[model samples]
Target: METAEFPAATSATDGWEPTLAAALLGAERAPPAPPGPLADLVAEADPGAALLARLAAEGALHRAGTGLGPEALAPTEPRDAFGPECPPAAATRLYGLLSEGYSARGRVEEWFALAAASGVRPPAWLFQALMLHRDSLPATAPAVVGAELDWLARACGEAPAREAAADGAEAADWAEGSVAERRAAFAAFRARDPEGARAALEPVFRKEKADIREALVHALATGLSPADEPFLEACLDDRAGGVRLAAQHLLPNLAGSRYAARMAARARAALTIESKRRLLGGTTHSLVVTLPEESPELARDGVEVNTWERRGGGARASLLRSILGRAPLEAFAEHPPRLWIELALRSEWADPVFHGLFSAAKRTLDPAWSEAMADITAEAYEGKVTGVRRTNEVLGMWAEALDLLPDAAWEARVGALIRARKIEVVLAVLAQGPEHFSEPFTATLLDWLAFVTRGSDALRRDLAKPWVIARLGDRLFPSEDAAAAAAAILARLPEEDTDRLRTQLTGLTGVLDLRAAIRRDFRSETTTGGMAQG
Candidate 1:
C-alpha cells in the first residue's frame, strides 16, 4: 500500500475541490465533446449532460438492492486513489471518478477513505456536489458527513472556511428548509439520541452570539421535550432575549415543567393592579385611576381609585402578590376576580395566565362569571385593533379566556341573547356582526367563529344549526337562531326543500346534550345556570 498525498497544483487557500470538479465536468463548455475519453466522461457527468443518467442508474440500483451504505453496499477495504503523490488535476479527477463509481456500486466507505488519505478538505460547494452526486448516503450518513466535518474542523486553515456544508450535515439544517420539515428532522435526530446531538451542539450553542444562538435554540426547540428542559432552563437568562424567549416558550410543554409552574406562581402572586388618583394639576376634579387588575367595577364608574385607596399601602399590588403567591390553580380559583387574570391575559403572559385561568375555571363551574369574563375578551379584541402585535396579544387573551370559561359559557352570548339556548345564542350574536362591522369588531367575530369551529366538543356545538351545518358540514354546526332564521326565510321553500331542512335539523336534535356544556360567562351577568349545563 502506497501513501497518497494531494499535491498543490492549484491554490489551496480556498475553494479547491468544487471549483476543480465544476471545471473538470466541463460545466462552461459548449455541446461538442472535450478532446479525449476523460473529456467525454467529464461532459457526460456534467449536469448539462450525464448527471441525470448517473442519478437514474443510482436510483434504480438503490431500489434494486445495489445502493450505498453498510446495508446496500459493503464498504471497500481502504485504498488510496492518489498513490505516492498526485497532482491537483489528477486528485480532482480521481475524486470525481471515485464519487461516481462508489455511487454506482453503492459504496461510500471508499469515498471516505480516499477523502481521509488525501487530506482533501473540499469547499462546501464541492462537498455538497460530492455528497449530492454520491446521493446514496443515508440520512444516517452523518457518520460519513462527520468524517468531512472532522477534516474541516481540523483544517481551520488560514482563510475562512465555506460557511456551511452543502447538505447542512455539519449543523442541523434548521436554517435552510421549511419550518415543518426542519422541525421534523431536528426533532427526529434529537429523539434518536439526544445526548449525542445536544452534546455536539453545546459548544456552538454557547459560543455563538445572540442571533446565532437564537436560531440554534429555535432549531433545538423542534427536538425539545422534557429531556431538553434542563438545558433550556439554563438558557432562560441568556444574553439574547430571543434565545431566552424561545427557551421559555418550550418550558411549559415539558413534563414536570417546574420552571414555568414556578414562574407562573410568582407572576400570579406578583402581578397586581394598583390604582391612584391625583388631582388634575390645576383642576379641582380627579382623574380616574386603575392599575393592572383593578377592574373598572372596583374603581366606581364616576370616581377615581388608586394605590392610595388600598387599605395597606399597595393593597392592589398586595392582592396580586397574594394571588401569585399561591399555586395549583385551585388556590387562584378561590379568587378568580383578581386583577391578575386581566393583566395576564392583556400581556399574554403565557405560563402565569394559563395556569391561573385553567386552575380557577376548572375548579368552579359557574357560567355567569365566565360571561363577564367574556366581556374582557371583547374589550381586548377591541382595544388592540391595529398592529399585528396587538392582534396576537388580543387573540392570545381571548383564547385563554375561552379556555377558562365554563364550557357552556365558552359559547354563550352576552346581554339579551343569553336567554336563548347555546346554538341560538351564538347565532343571534353572530348575526349582530353586521350592526358592528368595524375592523376590530369584525376581527372579534371571525376569531370567535374560528374558535367555535375548532374548539372543544362543547364549543363546537354552536356550529350545529341547520344554516351553519349546510355551510360547514356536521363538524361545524350552525347556531339555533341561524337555523331558525334560515327556517323562517326558507319556510316558503318548496315542500321538498322544507322537508329536507326539517329532516336535517331534526336529526341533530339528539346530539344536543346540554349536560355537557361548561358555561364560563361573567358573574356580573345573569345567574341562570342554563348555559353551563347545556
Candidate 2:
C-alpha cells in the first residue's frame, strides 16, 4: 500500500496541514512534530497529543485570518420592495408568537393579514426565519407576504424571471413533478379552465404512477362538472385501485351526471313506499326495499360486490343501501324528507340510509333536507329517539349533517350542544360551518363558554378552554366589544384559587391585549397609508 501525499501548500497557514492530517489518522500510524508558535508551548509534550492541541489553536487562527470583506448588495427597484416595515411592537409580538409553536398559526395568520392590510413588511431580520419555516404558514400566507417574499427572492437571486414565465414553468413541471406539485398545478389549472385542465391531464392519465394519478384525479374535485365526468367514469376501470376509488368518491358530487342518474334509477326501482293501516286508527307509510343482485352496471356505479364478505353477511342488502346513498336526492321527489327519515329509522339499514340521505342532501345543496337531517341528528344526539345510542358515531354523523346547514339554522344547535356538555360536538360543528360567527351568535357562545368554564370540573374546563380561547382570538376577539369580553372573562376568574386555570385565563388576557394593540396600530397605518411606529 502506498501512503497518500498531501497537495502543495497554497497559503502561509498551510504548515499546519500535516499535523492536522496526522492527528486525524491517529499517532499509531503517523507521529506529529511541534509546528510554528506551538513549539515553545509543547516542546516537551508527547508528540501526538501536542499535535492535536496545535491543530485546534492553529485552526482558530486560520478562521480568524480568512474573513472576507463584505460584498455590495444587489440593487432592488423601489417599487418592488414592500411599502413599509411593520411596527416595532407588532414585529416583536410576531417573533414571540412564532417562537411559541404551530398552535399560533391562526394568530400568525391574523397578524399577517393585519400587516398586509396595513401595507407594511415584516422586519428584515425575520424574513430568513419566515422563509425557512414557510411550510408552517398557511397557503394564504404567501399572498399576504407576497411582496416581502418576492423582494427577498430577488435579493437572493432565487426569484423567477416573470410571473407568466413562472406559471409556464409550473405547467411544464407538473408533468414530471412530485405528487404534491402535480396536485397543486392541476388545481391551479382547473380553477382557471376546468375543461382545459381535464383535457390536458387525460392523455397522460393512464401512464402516470398510481399515487400520482390518484392525486391528479382528486384535484378535479374543486371545479368538477359534467365536462369532467367522462374522464372520471373512465377512471373507474383504471389499473390502480386507488384511482378507481377516487373516481367513485367524486362521481357522487355531480348530481345530474349519467352516473348519478343511473344510481338514482336503481334506488327508485329498489325502494317502494306503501301505506299500512294501523290496528287502532291512523295510517303509516313504510319503506319496502327489494335488494337487487350485484350486476355490472351496479359495480361500475361504485357498488362493491365483496363488501358484504369483508364486513361479514348481508352483502346484497348493504350494496343496495350504498347505491341509494349515492343516488340523487331528486329520485325521492314524491316523498317529503321527513318520510324518508322515518322510513330509514324504521328499516334494518338505518345507518346506511341515514348517511346516504345526508350525502345526497350535501351533494344537491338542498336546504330543506339538510335541516330535516340536522333535526334527526339533534334528536338522536339528545337521546330523544328510541333505539339509537348517543355514541361518538352518532355525534359524528350529526356533526357531518349539521355542517351542511345554514349558520342561522345551526346557531341554536351549537348552544344546545354546549349546554349538554358536548363540547367536542360543538367544536366539530363550528369547524365545518361558516368561517365567521355572527355577533349575536358569538355573544351567545361566549356567555355559554364563560358559564361552562366557571361551573365545570378542572378536566372538563381544561378540555374546553383552549378551543374557547382559540375561537375568541380567531373570530370574536376582533369585534368592537373584544376588550369588554376579555375583561369580563378575567373578572370571572375564581378569586380563591390560583393555578393552571388562572394562568390560562391570564395568558388569554395577554393575547387579547396584544391583539387590541395590533388593531390600533393597524388602524393608524390604514389612515396614514404607511406603517405606524407604535
Give the winner by lDDT: 2
In model 2, the worst 10-residue window by lDDT is 66-75
Off by over 4 Å in 1: 1-184, 194-196, 219-223, 255-258, 264-268, 271-424, 428-534
lDDT of 2 by residue, 11-35 (tens): 3434456657767676656544433
Best of the candidates, TM-score = 2
- Give lDDT tens digits, candidate 1, residues 1-534: 233333332221222232344335553432332232223333364455554433343345345553232232334334323222323333354355456665333223433344444444333434545444434443433443445543444443312123444334445564346545555555556666667667766766677657666666676765566777777878876777788767755665554576646634544444444445657644222112222355432222111234555754554543343233223343334344534345545453433343445444434433644554556655656564222134644554455545555433444433223333334434534432221223333234334443444445544444544354332212222334333333343333234333444444443332211100101111112267233211
lDDT of 2: 0.71
Candidate 2, residue 183: lDDT: 87
* lDDT of the candidates, in the order given: 0.42, 0.71
lDDT of 1 at 44: 61
List candidate 2 stretches off by more than 4 Å.
Answer: 1-76, 79-86, 117-136, 142-144, 160-165, 168-171, 207-212, 276-283, 305-311, 379-399, 415-436, 452-534
